[model samples]
Target chain A: MNKNEIDNANKYLSKFARLTRNVLDEKELISLSQEKTLLDDYLQMEQLRFGFKYEINHSEDLDLENIEIPSMLLQPFVENAVKHGISKKATDGKINITFIKKANDLALTVTDNGNGFDTEKKNNGLGLLLSESRVALLNSIYKENRFTLAIQSATNGTKVSLTLSDWL
Target chain B: MRAILIDDEISNLENLRTLLEKHCPKVTIMATAQSVSAAVDAIEKYLPDLVFLDIQMGEQTGFDVLKLLPRRNFEVIFVTAYDQYGIQAVKFAALDYLLKPIDIEELINAVNKAEYKLATQIQTSQLDFLLQQLKKTDTHVSTIAIQMQSETRYVTLSEIIRCEADNTYTYFFLANSEKILVSKSLKEYADLLRPNGFLRTHQSHLVNPKYVKSWLKEDGGILLLTSGEKIPVSKPNKETVKQALQRQ
Candidate 1:
């Protein structure tokens, strides 16, 4: 491999190592920064695998240090966007993640300019199914602060958003 | 009920046959085909009440077979091994599907649903919708099917003004001054409608930006619609609401 490719390989390995460590940590809830790092590593690995055919964008306020969320809550949606949405596009695949604070809640959204799935279908991808169940389980544990998931899909793209009520 | 099975893989077809014979006794396998042409021929000859279609089959797809047919006179339950594009298309049309290594429970459920549709002789609107969706180069559909107690309502997306949550129920307000109360949760509709220009302004409210008249700064925040109805906007959603309105 060329020098640049070799550098990417090393970076990929490091990110993979970090993800493996985080996955095995056995924590049900993680800090926002930890979740952000996990997503960053995961997205980097995916981008490396795809030769960086897609772009990543973020819109956020820097108030994420204190909040905690269910472990790996955001990964599945991002994974889904890449695997289903971005993978099929010919060019200019974009993934946008937003982290904003609203009143007593924290709003998180992951959007992709890829082929969108049917939000109306119950039998969608396994990642989404598992995340839904995870959120439900989390809701049972955290009685006061409920985590709500909303997904919108069109031919152009799909957006998955989550609201953590009273989380702020 | 008579059924036809279509898949390029002999093993998959055989496995499905065995499953149907063992579990779904009411379904008789009338024909099985290994290609698009073969599947079309089988469907034409047997005129089965149901068909199990595999999404990917060499150069041609299951959709190609359906396209060859004149009209849908039977129920369809797609079977595939996690083909994302095929699955999404099938789902966008709101049809039944079972992933490969199919769960017996899911298989049975699909079979039962097909059976129910067959018995009712429900107009194949979903199949028609699927066919229409396949004809389009783009992904967006103009209408959403809302299942109510007595019937399913196909409401145009543009006509919807707002949706309100009532515990487990959702109330859809239309531009024509008609309100629809659906049994499903508001969160579900919010998710389904978000990409179609709907904004969730509060825990209980989802508003279509096209119908939004103004964002009132009073009462913490409230949105006025073209119908002169007011919707409360929560503090967190104020910026989002402003941005959405500004975009409009």
Candidate 2:
């Protein structure tokens, strides 16, 4: 193979290895700080590839540093924010990942400035199905049924939010 | 036979030229282009008999190359990386293509097929068919283009009720009770129209699941459609028919 081809192959392999590490780390509980760091790094990698911007919102009084929770719980939704929203967008694609302290639960949202599609469609894609199943599984693990995932899509943009009670 | 080679990759273009020179001696290399603009220039200047095309070319695609063309008197043999949707659309359109990295046998076969097609001129309106297929690959069943003797007919999938196969020809039974005979085989339409509520209940019949009103279990299962047409469901196809109804 040529030098260019070899370099390209190595670049792809390193990227694949990093993602494989994430999948392997899915077995453990990831803290809020770890989750933020992981997703932020992921957003950076995607920015290098697709030239999209990522934003995060949090407050100082949240006390969200070391609380352990499910691993890779928010990856699917965040992935959708890029695939559906950012990729389809022609210019200035931006994604916002927010963690708001709700009254009884912690609400996490992944919002994208992308042209949205119909959420009611049966065969939208497997990403939504996988995310729904992951939420259902996470809900069963908790003591109460305090987990919810909502998807709202329109021409303006798309916002997907998940609420986890007692998650704080 | 003269041909134009279009690919963004210099290596792939060189490889194809070498392969063509070695295997297909009849096809003379007229020109080589690296992008859609260069391809258009070559196509206009040479007006080659066949054009070997790559689907992806930097910011432009093989479809974009076709879009800028002034004429399509030449045949095309698409060469693309393995793309599920793109390949499916090409198959539905019944166009010739060679997959990458190019295989010697597939390359020769594609070139020979294109040569035969160009010589015989069996089907005249391929570019229109290709454009329709590209448009259809993005959405659910909206409209289908059927080739007529001297022209093309576009009909919404909802208007068609059933399709009957008679040897090589297909008879489309529309909602208006008019039967249009198309020269294409039924199997081609079966794959294209299957997702759009069309079911192959019998070897000779393809019926729309929405038009089916009832099915009688006696005498090897006969479906009574809303049009009062009795379509036989073979024993082997009973499970298929049941599953199709359950999906509805």
Candidate 3:
């Protein structure tokens, strides 16, 4: 992106960050999965432009016992997916976000059916790198291997999975 | 009535001091603090009965000062710059606070009331209860006191139509065609009403449980109220409506 385009994108991302903070601050009692979905849907609506669908499906009894993470960790990831994954495609797109608890971890998977890219390469842009760093921070709070970040891209789509320590 | 004036601006500090001294002679100006550290130290050392606090001083707010102190012994009269919304918040809090360019008459009145209340030995417990209720008003279901002309009425949590926030006032729309202006914010009312079956379906609107006729899912979602007024539903609160409807 050029200077003006980069500046505009930065402004929009900052706005998303601010709105996320406002929503979190105003909400008194938010569960972990609920908070994550809130950030995800906010980014999906605010960042995407075309025919994109965002769905958050989670079963009841999700482990959310007094677990609170940073305010806007998922927004950047969602933004990265929309900007790089879906925006490059001409057809409609859909992002499915699912939260599930297994064994001793809380697992989240975000999958989108759009133009995929090479995940082996290190040039995942600042947004993706920032997302990686955030997951690393989440790892620091939980133990090593308590947090996992995985990205895979096929010919038609991309899937990103994150697993954080089960605090419940 | 002992008080402390804390503000970075010399002119504002001096102006407030003059106003307090002239109009509220009973309120003794114990000391003044310009910075956060100085203010904290003075508050600890002098322990004034009240503090005429400026919200903005360099980078810190009056709330920061309150957070730093272990326990607030004195009451606060927050002197803000131009946040009428914040002023309304303070009013809703029922804690005595004043706005800047401190009006002499208003300052005197506030200080006098504080003096009278203090002299009466009004239970700190009661004052604390009021303060607690005020803070909870921002996020809990609260019975708003409304006065219309000669008649006074309080529209309960279930009778509210919607609340519109306009600067310092929130206009509460009732089931009847009457709108009562309360000195609070939409968020405050939402907090007060959330547990009482009121959902903040819109950023600017809060709906009672008995009023939602149907939900319309279009581009975003909208709620058709019993009065046929269409209110936009905030995406975050869609599930809240569903949950509420299920319980109903």
Best by TM-score: 1
Give per-model TM-scores: 0.57, 0.50, 0.38
TM-score of chain A of each: 0.88, 0.84, 0.71
Each prediction's whole-model lDDT (CA): 0.77, 0.76, 0.65
How do the residues B1-248 of candidate 3 rate in per-residue lDDT, one tens digit apiece? Answer: 78889998888888677666656778889999898888999999998888888877887766667767876767677787654434544543445666544545557777776676556654343233334444554555355444333333545556677776554357888887877876555555665456667776654677886888887887467888898989876544556576787788
Provide the lDDT at A63 for model 3.
Answer: 36
Query: Distance from true position, residue B173, model 1, in Å?
Result: 2.8
lDDT of 1 by residue, B43-99 (tens): 999999999999989988898998899977998999886546566556545578886
Report the lDDT tens digits of candidate 1 across residue range A1-168. Answer: 366563355456556765775677565556566678778878877775563354333335433432446678888898898889887663577788777778667888999888787888888978888999988987776665678999999989898999888655
Per-residue lDDT over B1-248 for candidate 2, one digit per residue giving the tens place of the 0 to 100 score = 89999999999898888778878999999999998889999999999999999988887788778878868888889988644436655655556777676657668888987887767765556566667667654565466667565545667778889998775678999999989998766755775687677887765688988899998887768999999999988544566688788878
Ranking by TM-score: 1, 2, 3
Residue A52 local lDDT, model 1:
35
Q: Model 1 residue B72 lDDT?
A: 77
DockQ-based ranking: 1, 3, 2
Instruction: List ranges where model 1 is wrong by over 4 Å.
Output: A1-71, A74-168, B86-89, B147-152, B165-170, B181-188, B234-239
Candidate 2 vs 3: which has more lDDT: 2
After TM-score superposition, the amount by which residue B217's alpha carbon in candidate 2 deviates from its true location, in angstroms, is 1.5
Compute DockQ for each candidate against the true complex: 0.03, 0.01, 0.02
